[model samples]
Target: MAALTPDTVDIIDPDLYVRRGYPHDEWAVLRREAPIYRYERANTDPFWAITRHADIVNVSRQPELFHSIQRLFVTINEEGSPAPDEAILRQLLNMNPPEHGAYRAIVNRRFTPRGVQGLREQIDRITAEVLDGIVDRTECDFVTEVAARLPLAVIAEMFGIPRADWAMMFRLSNMMIGPGDAEYAGDETILETLQRARMEFFQYFSQLCEDRRQNPRDDLASVLANGLVNGAPLPIFELMSYFALLIIAGNETTRNATSGGLQAFIENPAQWARLKGDPSMAAGAAEEIVRWTSPVIQFTRKATADTNLCGVPIRAGDELALFYPSANRDEAVFDRPGVFDIGRNPNRHIAYGIGEHFCLGANLARLELQVMFRQLAERLESVESAGPLHRMRSNFVGGIKHMPIRYRMRPRA
Candidate 1:
């Protein structure tokens, strides 16, 4: 890998993510040379990129100092902080301890190991059905046909959303995270695109909530609609934002991870073969894939008071981007960081994030990935890139969006 120069320091550029799947070598330099390097582009306040594993842990641990409410996206300081009246980030993100904990607890039980374990049979059924859709075809866009399908279904079924609406849910989720991409944004500004998606999401979910209230079901939607926090009903807007986050955030991360996982197997066939040789390795392989692919690239944190992180200077109101992809590969934490070993041990990857805001769906995602590779190891005969792989032009949900794969698979039993 070439040295990163001043000409190449614009790591936040969305184009860079699309070009290299990620700026891995560049990030490697940051992790090695400057774990907390301040990054700046034109017309915006600079932010420290927290590239090392330890530094990220420190930041995540002190959520009170590094707030999550004012900014959930990387464009936080750039787009201006989410205002009190207009910003629902407080609901989806930008939260402090007690508020964050109570809100997160609503669905926390369902995503626990014991909770997600109950869904294993359903997950297997969905995985088998999704794979079955692509098995007969000699070629398919693995992203749309397979990787993107199961998570959408899992979340929709959890919400009691009808199967017929999964496609719309998928499209809407992309619009929420993929506004910077030309395919989703068109001529609109990113804010405009996000706002538009939120508006549509709000309208649809409001009706969904109303129905759940009138005719409750034993599902996540009903739980949320009727859910109580401090013995009071959740505020309407906040509840709506939670619904939006569950659909968009919950759906996108797993979907992108599954796609990125397959891409990893294709690139590192030895790992694929290793998994094929032993289906039981699926559990560890799934973590390696998440660590390797890092579907959610960046999340923002803001400083509430003066602080020094890993011997670096800091100040109140300072903003930082926790580059999860880079942190997952920190040489200090991961031995032979560049290698992709399916059985890599002590895999403390933060792909699902860490600390207070650790991804609520982490257990579910792990199960989904484990199940996916297990079946693939057992059934997939061969898989390779059929055409040029294309990544989503996103700085947020880093993913391979157009993965055309040529493959053969045994029929589902």
Candidate 2:
């Protein structure tokens, strides 16, 4: 194989990720040779590939200059136009500072350390239930059976969704996030599938909003449905968008982290033993796992004004893709960028991102991961792969579609 260069590499290719996981080799090359390389590919829009950790932070911090509004998320250049209702894309993720801050403040209190701590007991219960189901079995698909369940239950309960609707939520999210994958991809084009998923989401959330408005409850759904923003009800589109964001953000990324974390442990048995011996390291382990599996691959932001980053001059309207996985493993910051050390201290991986637009559910995600791995560390006795690993065919989210594992566990004492 020839050496990969900025010109030869195609990082945004969804098929590249499905066939071979994270292009760390390609990213390493870019990080060293051209941390701010201009990536121009056929079919996809040209953008600067921000590979270094410091550069990503520099771009993420100044939301005023590098706006998130122009380009919300990175697409793999699918063959169809998106839904005409572009208002659905006007969620919190795509907003700029003042508006972003305001919308974020709506549910900000619930995701704070204090708020997430309140849900710790619930998370513990959910984790126990999920593990209990697999304790009697010798083999299970960890991604679907174990890793995916806990977060789904937790987030569903938060929304006051019935247990029956969990499957619906799961299917919808997969369609939205992994539309490029054969399993999720239908006869329709990727954008059309996305539009259909969004409509399905809209229909469900619209009814939920109506129900909550008539008889509000303590769940996040009810809070958003009836809650006032700026002394008025939130627009219907924004409300639905809010629900959709929470459902996907709260579920998909966390499950991937959990599955990827376990995969790391299986590969690095010594680290598993280290964590198993001292469960107290779960906090650090969670952080390490997030860094190891930066689920959100890349998000594009457009320069609001012509400026410079890393000595490279940026023209206004130029878009840049901040590669989170690469930033998480940058050599300048982390001690051993490639090593997955569970007890890596002072680990400041920006898997959840940095600055004003940092993930709103970050604290909750940390809590979920910490509690989850702690339980696994205490009970997971032995484990290994039962079949070939399957990854989501999407460059946007580094999703593990299926990870079958055979394992034993010490019964909960």
Per-residue lDDT of candidate 1, residues 303-327 (tens digit): 9899898778899987889999988
User: Considering every candidate listed, which one attains the maximal lDDT?
Assistant: 2
lDDT of 2 by residue, 247-341 (tens): 98899999999999999999999999999899999999999999999999998899999998878999998889999999998999999889999
Which residue pairs collide, candidate 2? none
Whole-model lDDT, candidate 1? 0.83
Residue-pair clash count for candidate 1: 4
Q: What is the C-alpha RMSD of each candidate to the true structure, in Å?
A: 2.2, 1.5
Query: Which residue segments of model 1 deviate by more than 4 Å?
Result: 5-8, 75-89
| lDDT (C-alpha) at residue 412 in model 2 | 82
> Which ten contiguous residues of candidate 2 have the minimum total lDDT?
81-90
Off by over 4 Å in 2: 81-88
